[model samples]
Target: MDPRLTLVVISSCIALCLGCTKELSVGELFYGSVIETKSSPSAKHCQILCTYELRCAIFTFSNFKCELKRDDSGAIRAVSSSIISGRSLFSCAAEKKEACFRDEYSQVAFKDKPYQTVRTTNEKECRSKCDNDPLCSFYTFYKSSAQCELKFWNLLPTAEVLYSSTGNLVSGYSSKLKLNINAKYNCLSIQSKGYLLENDYFDYTYSGAAFTVEHCQTLCNLNPFCRVYAYRTNGHCRLKLIKDSHTQGAKLDYVISGLRQTDCKPNFVGKKTTATT
Candidate 1:
């Protein structure tokens, strides 16, 4: 009855569909490339810096170099000369694609740190958290544990497709760089009084609280800027102020002790991964 109106509606619908489409691709290595590089204690540290850079999808770093690239299409490959090994970083940050994109997953981006433990919610909140933090590069959240881990690369495989229980745990796109630099060093590591020297310090202590050393470490790890930690039977987590003495506190469920450390590494490197697909 209204042929002209129907025709106009169909044309508009087609335009909308065409407006929202994108193509996707896959390969052995992904993200992009390392357009940059810097000196770091280890390859991981270098990777960390590269991951922080916008458009730094993947990189290869050595004592002398760091490389970044882009991979939207093709069976691309990278040949290396300097870096021992390099890989991509992980990401869970989603993108709002136009409606024409067929894949539902294509629209969602993941986030990965200063990652607050995963709570039930949407990517917007997670991204908001990351965006606010100057240090956060990307993030990934686990559906099972509801744990969110922040990341460096453009990708965040916070969703572990394949994983090993122990040995070397690589995230979605992470690999240790086989740099000429020393492996014992990284951007961050744990420090205790015994590990380094002390000059100035502060300690806030509590008592009669029971906790395991393991539990104490978890608390410290969770803290945003927790450099080191000490726990005793007194149920206290000494967020200590340390100096040149090189002393570290303790972690015990029911023991009494002080906390301090020296000679601790510069940054903490509990674990890391690059987001390559």
Candidate 2:
């Protein structure tokens, strides 16, 4: 099972009973982050945009005015709306409603033999425990048993098998992935500020990826449509689009093959780098 499948309990049971319901609607206030914050109302407008965007788990309105930010991960909300706040959608029913975490998933995993049971207070704490232990990668929390389970291996069982506590048990796998590459590799010769010898990879996220001369060459070689490529020792990855594909092993601007593959052991990238995963 994926570490994100674990369930966390909230301590707000008592709080939920005492507090009056403060329901939220599509147009209601949703706390979010202002990806760009040059002005005050930018955050508020962002909130509106978030409301329009489906699949948006939640949003934060903060930073002087209201900043609209997306929270699909449903993990942590390191946001500041200067005002608006929210509890996890999973925790909306807790007695303390907004005071406890109620995410169905946690970032925890097993280490030794039979996976041990866990009882985390929230998703964050569950993940924190797994992260602290390098041996962990994924976790499963039984909603009924209120137990968190961890994993140390790579296994993907069906939902039927996973949720079936014998019938409804949660099951997941470690996110850590070990990659092995063929020797005929693509490599970049690094100068100051560049990867001593590195390669770049982009999951197609607009940004958050970097490349090097050698890395660019390797990327092109591995990819078909890599007619031209560029690299910056700036520690940031940038890939350009070329009309061509299948440009086999051509060197351009210090680009070359022989670069070693960097093992991506998902340890903290969130999507697939949590140390336990």
Candidate 3:
């Protein structure tokens, strides 16, 4: 081989090897040190573009936009449902793909009607059916009835679509759909198997279905006006606003409630009281 050609081949191999080491981290959004921005159709494409950009060290892709970053060392990593972030290896390489799914919520179901219903022997089979269907984005499995409900929508549904249900129900979403499940909030405390702080002064603003008590708390946290939340095992969530510093409570089976730590006013306090129904 010619000396010049031999040197060129060795350089090409090094570049290829460098690119093959890049790995992806899904559901993470990295902030700062953006060197450039480009429109990409997918996370994989954004990663490929980063590999070709000499200055790109890391990239975050979301909603068809890609941001190339120079330094990820001090960058803040936030959990996001839509954003996908990865570090680049400074050379072009094939994108790696993998099966990804979000954690499942027990005793939960989607309020929206499923696109298709199939009778399955177990939750695994139900999940398999959803995995095989191109249109399925989320699903609910009823253990008692041995039925799977495959759900679909033009876009991913919000947390409001989920509701607490029978103990036999379970629900989950595909990570590819990128549903927003990570909301920042802290609970002062969670009361289980009963509702608290229900009184005339603290009337509920509205009610909806929540997949879990945490889901209900997320909804309350996102609502600027929400001060307290109550969740029932039957898949019901109630958001409330309380003006009084003192509140009363009652016993209700299969119900849980709590106050958001951020919303706990200095004067506001919960007073649990027994009720005979």
Candidate 4:
């Protein structure tokens, strides 16, 4: 082999092994199931944070904050242009690592929510204050006055009302925010009437005539890999599989879809048993 070609092959292999490449979806936000949150300066920095955590499979970056999610199973919501969501392809054991820079939103301010105001030379130092303070959720820095305002919410508000645009202001979230996962809440029974989740299937394992939606659910329940099912009024049943992630579907007329609350655990009998009505 040519020496240049050999080097190229070696580099490619190393990149794949470390999962250097990431798949980013701009203007997307994954709801719920956040394992951890941190302040990030850019989408690329957010990906690095996701890569560092063993449990982080996907992440969403918005308003200079990075939300690390356990998987891609959560509902993906289209949000503002600032939001960027992506999946990490790297393994936890990868050798390559990078330092994180302070992420800030210029000409933006988080309004009417400052709990503590302090003096700081730059946004990086301002961010450090928020990172150290447990109560701080976000902070805004004023460029001309060199003022840093650390803010926290008594109750978290909706994303729409989180930030506002202003000149000479920079804002960002805390560097680290660990979320408590309630297993019971995360594993709730999900059912949607009159909807068909389109183009979101991992695999279409089985499809056949089913009497009712309940019957289609039963079919999904029996399959070890099936995580979601869709039933049509015309008696067609479709079972889909997405291992270890919840499935989100779109709405369509005359269709019903649902997600299996619990993981599919199959118990094998002495012989293969036939499923009956």
Q: TM-score: which candidate is best?
A: 4
Give the poorly placed runs of model 4, Cα more than 4 Å off: 1-18, 27-42, 45-49, 60-68, 72-83, 89-93, 109-116, 120-139, 150-161, 172-277
Query: Tens digit of lDDT per residue, candidate 1, span 1-277?
Result: 2332233233323323334222212222333433444433334444444333323444444433444443223234544444444332323112311111111121122322334444535444544555555335445444445444555431111221222233221122222211111113333334332221232223432221213333344333323344445543333345433342245433323332333222222122112212111
Model 2 per-residue lDDT tens digits across residues 115-207: 555787644555555555554645565555656665443221111112121433333433332211111222433222222223222322122
The weakest ten consecutive residues by lDDT in model 4 span 265-274
Q: Residue 167 lDDT in model 1? A: 24
State each candidate's clash count.
90, 56, 2, 3
Q: Residue 42 in model 2: shift from native, Å?
A: 24
TM for every model, in the order presented, reads 0.22, 0.23, 0.30, 0.34
- Please tell me which model should have the higher TM-score, number 2 or number 4: 4
In terms of lDDT, which candidate is stronger, 1 or 3? 3
Predicted structure 4: lDDT: 0.59
Q: lDDT of each prediction vs. the true structure?
A: 0.33, 0.32, 0.58, 0.59
Q: Tell me the tens digit of each residue's lDDT in model 4 across 141-221.
A: 888899999876422211112344557778776654322211112344467887667664334667775544654665565
Using lDDT, give the best candidate's number: 4
